[model samples]
Target: MANNDIEVGSRGSLPRKDYFEPLPAPMIDMEELAKWSFYRAIIAEFVATLLFLYVVVLTVIGNKTQTDPIIGGNLCGGVGTLGIAWVFGGMIFVLVYCTAGISGGHINPAVTFGMFLGRKISLIRALLYIIAQCLGALCGCALVKSLQRDRYNHYGGAANQLVDGYSKGTGLAVEIVGTFVLLYTVFSATDPKRNARDSYVPVLAPLPIGFTVFMVHLATIPITGTGINPARSFGAAVIINDKEIWKDHWIFWVGPLIGATIATMYYQYVLRASAVKAIGSFRSTPPTRH
Candidate 1:
């Protein structure tokens, strides 16, 4: 009887459910996986960029142009400049949420190339990302062409070019300043140290990044239509097939890449070091666990 009691007690004391041990941190070396992971990320970036361009171009074409008045004499829909900015900004908001984890949400070839130049990304990965971005842009342009069809002749698909009376110098300046602001925001928002607080990481980054694009459009729409992202400009320009736009496209790519490179350097050498010091201070203090 005593033996039976012991067994029963032991059985009762045992946990009702098995305790689960956490899976070990993934053993894949980052360097070893870098090549393949980057390619996957590039593909994700491409898809995301394509979605962004397609949505924005379609909206612009459908809303902005004056199609023949309906039988009842009314415009179907019209999204003005501000509305267009919102649409473009909103698309970025969605894409970043979807793709940030996969590719750091760099849907711009200039950004990818800049990071590569800064040594933040490997050369193999950068090439793959550029290829993906270009292909994605082409796909997006093709979609816009198909959707608009006959209307395509009237629609420029939101292609970037200097407005009449705006000089090449003015366009270059706008692109440089706009891109610098954007890259700076990207660096601040994504730096793990700056966004170390649990609440900020996933939520805040997208907002600022999206807002930056909106603000850029607001400021530069008249001057150059704000080609802060070269992939965006390329996508639209390809659809428009404007040789003049293509000739000036170098400014978009070069300016953004320069700005991103500068921002990355500042973040790495100055901001990151300060962040490390700040985090270190917290770590040195003993935690009083309850």
Candidate 2:
């Protein structure tokens, strides 16, 4: 009867167990040095981040220029706020789809850090990805400045700033909550159990992540220019060289990182139940002298 009950339950329409990977042991191995694919992954992150910032920042600059009567007038009608949000969300979807297999498609440092804390990536790889992303962002912003030259200055160079009437505390909170939404979505979308259970999920994976970015921007842009990615904010700050940007710059880094850390902990421990096992392990140690 117990065996029959177990069988019947298995056949029922109940949800299955959540997927969770074992925590990765830290290592610095020569194999990573020997692998060509590691370098390729780094390059993918660079290019993806570069493309992301370039297109999005260009849109921002163009919008500012168009709205300025002294410059564009009615000719450059601009895409407006809604269009800017779409550009950011759309670019992320396309980029993630293209680079998911090779680089895990982490275009943001905060995302990479979140994955690192979750043990989804190695420490070495995480560090490298962050460096590549920052460099890529710098190059992207530089290109926009180079092309626009005069307009870049007039339009504020797409720098993220705390707008009038909003306090720094409010700005910081926006980045934190906005980034938590994005990172949490990435975790849930890529959860192995979710994919194993639903074959159709792979095709729709990027959509929710992109939509999260879009929605977050719509709510937070007026407050802090929607800086969920630290590298993106830093890139613009470097190029614009504005003291105000520099003063509030720490909020971008601190907020997103805090959000990512929280997401990593929640998804790994609570949602995935990764700590169910407390078994001990043994490893060989060097012999001690007498």
Candidate 3:
């Protein structure tokens, strides 16, 4: 999800001048279905997503358990909101690092959706990847439930909920903006052009990606519980199965999806200046024969 997009596209004028090669992945690359690497990538996505959801959900439940004196027996307060943010962010950093080589480390559906819109991945691959991620997330939450059904049920399954004061729209807004921050960071971090031009600059892709998630959660956790990743939201919702959780469920999916779309367009047209490149290509003069 961070560092492995193919680079073969229009290198207008001098290859160095183009800055990026935008190869639109085929819409239906059936050939990928036959490859072992494709299946390998799918499995990687599954396990990575599973671990991501598993750890984050567990941390959330644990924090709630400790914070409530009635339940925790005055456990000296739980790992507060700050700690929860760290766990989410830290786990992302660890998981992305671990699986990036295998499946580009796409543990989140929003990241995969953004990549799809940018044509970085084939439609078939993107679809399957999303399915695998969602299932993995479900299993991860289910794991937490299986281990401590009472505790899990006690903590409301850690499903994202719109806080008491916020309106549904406000909750939706946070999800969109939070996801935008995350997806935008993903695009900027994995930019092939930046990587090529600034080869000497030492930067780890996973670091920023993880930090973006952490920061977004910090700001929006109180709003919509920060559903920047659709798969993350979906898993928790499915496992919890409480009627109340379903009330704002649409916000989780819609907000992240819309945010991803915006980020994809913003990166391609505004930040990357794809529009400028197109106009330049149309206007450039052909060299006359010597």
Candidate 4:
């Protein structure tokens, strides 16, 4: 077959070329330490994660607590689940858009892990990004506590744990699936193949990614408090410091990392990445003897 996309009745179209050109990120790029841009990227991750956790947790606390005293019940309250989902989604859109050029807009440790697993970022960068994100999350949640100490602890502001009737297994599974959805969207939205093929995808990638986050949150909020981002969960837990909430704390991190791994595998292998091409291709003519 020639070097072009070929059509199969059942398979749609298959491109002979991988069409992905970038070399894998180096495991240890010492030279990156000298680049101010590298540190800037780390800072961007920190600030973005900080803003993300701060805004979202504050919204959660306010929404849950801001009930109508006149009504004298929990019937009509704050923005509700729908609004909370929107905040998570919308904030992600804004944050990703603002810092994409600088830090690739990885506000979540799960996202950073997925990028590193996919070979899109260096190991060093990934480590630093995770550290920055976690620190930022800690600070963001601390800020909320500082302003509303009683409400923060009293209302269970942002701590992630299984609600009543949910098992540890259920919590873990939901986190895995939630993070899988998020990382899958991130990979698809940022794929170079898609960008080169679809003229508009690169410019508006954040929209779909943000929408996915919103959708995931709406699905998982009542069950596990939607802990797709480990950093977000960590920050909230640390600031809230409820002993009961720590029982299932590992679910948030382990689940999301597992989800990220699954998504990476699905994108890189199941969806026909370089690994598929490694099987070799047909030749128009057989090789001649040397």
Candidate 5:
């Protein structure tokens, strides 16, 4: 019944109507998204830094009042220098957990500069982070001053300085070693291979790192009031306006930077090589695409 000499297969096919179906909205550029994410991270870092400094300064002020009451009394009124160390260590732990994913939780400029030196961050990014951290610290100090303008003479806000008998060299040594331990723990805990399971690390990372800061403060508090973090010291010192404190501030910066640099390099090159090798081997395996 078909027409004779008509060949259905001989006709070329027409395009499908669905070919004009609306395409999904264009996807965002991942590079632009990453840049935006990084900007957010920096802002988070600023917020974290402000919170950390505020808590520390307030604690120091509180403890100073506790200690000052008993000049020569039978009872020791203050929690003592060791207690201050614990305060700092504990605060750091809480802050890190709250902001680690967002900003790598570097509330300290020394830590940031150290990471920068280790090539973990780009120069421009590092610069931005440092500015944010410094500004945050300054703002925290300003807040303390505003709140206690009438009580400044009594509180002093936990500024750091060399003890009466301690020399500059001794203070520097303490800071370097103390910061080395703190930063080493930071590198280890945040390291993907070291804490391969994210759940385990989020819980475990803060303890050791926090305790290390506490222990370091205990050992060095007598020597330099334990200014392992220059930002912390700077925050308090600016409010106190002690010229001597400002003069000695360079040691805190230099020591922590040196220690962090060494620790980061050791972690990146020596400790992580095996993990790197494993990842490389996995990538090199050819896939059997069926």
Candidate 6:
């Protein structure tokens, strides 16, 4: 059996290398907490989230004006529900394209939590990012309030609320399913193998991710107002300042976190597996044989 004569075309049935990254041990590396890039990423997350909230909330207000004569602004000239979806989806694409390199463009807390579970980021980093995102969202919504003044209160500030006939259970289900779709797309688009194969299309990753948000909004907007991102929901709820809107607030956080957990487990354990040890492994001894 000469090595060269064995077979060239018959190995196509073999499996490819697993691409999953293992969990990082010590998951709270303080050194990562000390890096300048870490702080820079926090800033990027904050600014990206701020811009995202500002733009999307404004679009919501405009949509409200058209659909509800009581508001009466109609700046979008009756753009309707479809237009709101486009605004959310379009803003996600632009923001992700701009901040993907900086903070992974995780304007959503649920996405950041998903990455954390898959060991794509440290626990501390994830926590900081969530905080920054929440703060940015608040500030963004506050700015909208400042500019819109009277209209801001009248238009609902784009808060997520369960509409008529929808119970708390229904709202929970909507957030879970919507966040799952989004987190799944986030994981797939940013998969190392996918990025490698699609290197020619540098911008392709964020497009599908953004489209996921767009499609989810179209389906869920009339239900729970689409709380795929807990931070987005929280910021709006806070500014809306009505105890009634806050009643179901727990659904947004619980549903999205659960969805993120499920998506991360499915992707890391089932979608891809890899030989590389998880970075930051804290084992007392190496696994190599003597």
What is each predicted model's overall lDDT from 0 to 1?
0.71, 0.84, 0.84, 0.86, 0.71, 0.83
For residue 279, model 4's alpha carbon misses the true position, in angstroms, by 5.0
List runs of model 6 lying over 4 Å from the truth. Answer: 1-26, 71-76, 273-290
- Give the higher-lDDT candidate: 4 or 5: 4
Which residue runs does candidate 5 get wrong by more than 4 Å? Answer: 1-34, 70-75, 197-199, 273-290
The C-alpha TM-scores of every prediction are 0.76, 0.87, 0.89, 0.88, 0.78, 0.85
lDDT of 3 by residue, 85-116 (tens): 99899999889888877788878888899998
Q: Report the alpha-carbon TM-score of model 5 versus the true structure.
A: 0.78
In angstroms, how far off is 275's CA in candidate 3?
A: 2.8
**Model 1 root mean square deviation, Cα atoms:** 11.1
For 186-248, candidate 1 gives per-residue lDDT tens digits of 777775433323335667788888888888888888788788888888878877887777888
Using lDDT as the measure, name the better of candidate 2 and candidate 5.
2
Give the worst 10-residue stretch by lDDT in candidate 5.
1-10
lDDT of 1 at 233: 87
* Ranking of predictions according to TM-score: 3, 4, 2, 6, 5, 1
Clash-forming residue pairs, model 3: 1-104
Predicted candidate 2 versus true structure: per-residue lDDT over 1-290, tens digit per residue: 11111111145566444333344636454577679999999999999999999999999998887778875466448888889999999999999989888999999999999998887888889899999999999999999999988888777788898899999899999999999999999999887666656656777888888998999999998899999999899899998888877999898999999999988888877776555423321213322222
lDDT of 4: 0.86
